[model samples]
Target: MHDDPRLEELVKQVRASRKYSAISEALVRRIGAAELCKRATLQDAVKATKKTLHQIAGLYLANAHPPYDAWLRQIIQAPDDTARRAVLRSIMNHHTSTRERLPILDAFYARVLADLGPVRSVLDLACGLNPLSLPWMPLAAGATYHAVDIYEDLAGFLRAALAALGVAGKAEARDVITDCPTDAADVALLLKALPCLEQLDKAAGAAILDTINARCIVVSFPTRTVGGRQVGMRENYAARFAAMIADRPWRVERIEFVGELAFRLTR
Candidate 1:
């Protein structure tokens, strides 16, 4: 597909848009190629690809150019963990998905990670600003975290933030659907990520779950729309999640919060 001049032009057009310029080129190319297969014309493919990009990522970011440098300076200058958490909370509010979880942040990690004793490593996929919640997780001393997202800038910010928080890990801009991370970890976090992944590929949720190398995987879904309307998303997503894991042998446990539904799969 890369050899096709039409597909190449489609990717260039999509990336030329200011709104999508920072997205992972791998993701843009992947979505653009798929759109080309379905659309009748290059213009149509570009339009469809942009729409999908907005749904999967653009809508979540309140600020396209967040002051990561300033945030890092604040984190490093802060006197203690409380001060660092305050700065992290402010940064997280910039993402709609993470903002919605603020109300439940205190108990969210505790409940989901409670059973897993002394987590030494984590793999956070489609991570967004979720890694900022590291201060609240029950991590062992010198725990390592690996986070991945499609936005290059976000991944860069996360990489620096991880260092500032004194955690050892790496973050990268990756198209998780096309190239899911294979690194082994004690726990893998797919928090509210399946729905977004499925938006790109119907089988993405199951594919990632099957391929991720972790002893336990934590998956979550938003129970409300971005507009804050409750339309039985909890029930809908729960049923879908059940179907995804029904054939697997991993034991499953369900947990529900104010605006999210989560499931923990242990192998």
Candidate 2:
């Protein structure tokens, strides 16, 4: 933290924004001057709580995907007016709960860690701003972790987060659909980041899904509903994903749909 005037300015801006009052309050409470001092060198408590905050942020948005979806649709079709940027930023600022992410992570750990011997590597796909799976690094023990994402900001964040957590990993900005490296791993985790929506084109998504054939694949997606309507306005992607893998050597061991997302852990 080290008394960053920049963060101070961000806090001020967040508080001053009328639309971001709730987030402003939460952000202010989460980082005080003293906490900021400790955050710089990656103090134990700050690191741990920031880790938790990261999870909270993901679940927060995952829960809001439904309303967020409607908001996005309206913005996309809003005639490209001056209000578009404001609307999009507001939608992006929406948050998710950390409580929800833990349960899903716990379940994933339970299933994957079972009888996992000599597990020494991981390939994480579409790692977002927080790299939700970074918390599992220690548990991964002697493994080398590699993460890829389309967002350079997120990839950089993953590098920083892992460094702060005292874990080693490599992260790169690459299209998950086009730049999957030749290297393989004992496990591949795709935490709610299956590029299905981004692709939009069924053929492209199918190709992306086809390339992944790790010993284990953890696929998660926004569930069927958020504010009563499906998050993606459709639930067919789950079936489509299944169809893509039907003839592969892998087998779907479990499929759990929670909140606005679903988790599929297959082997």
- In model 2, the worst 10-residue window by lDDT is 18-27
Model 2 CA deviation exceeding 4 Å by range: 1-103, 130-132, 136-138, 195-200, 224-235, 260-267
Instruction: Please list the C-alpha lDDT of all candidates, in the order they appear.
Output: 0.91, 0.50
Q: CA RMSD for every model?
A: 1.1, 18.1
> lDDT by residue for model 1 over 1-267, one digit each (tens)?
666689888888988888898899999998988888899989999999999999999889897667788887988898987888898899899898899999999999999999788899999999999999999898899999999999888889889889988899999999999899998999999998899999989999999999999999999999999999999999999999898889998999999899999899999
* lDDT score, candidate 2, position 222: 58
TM-scores for all candidates: the values are: 0.97, 0.54
Q: Candidate 2 residues 1-267, lDDT tens each?
A: 535655555455434433333332333434433355555443443444344333433233443123533653555564653455444334434433223354455454555445545557777775543343444333457567787754344455556545544467787766554455557777676755554324323465456555765666666665543334555523566676767777766666645535424444445
Q: lDDT of candidate 2 vs native?
A: 0.50
Q: Which portions of model 1 miss their true places by more than 4 Å?
A: none
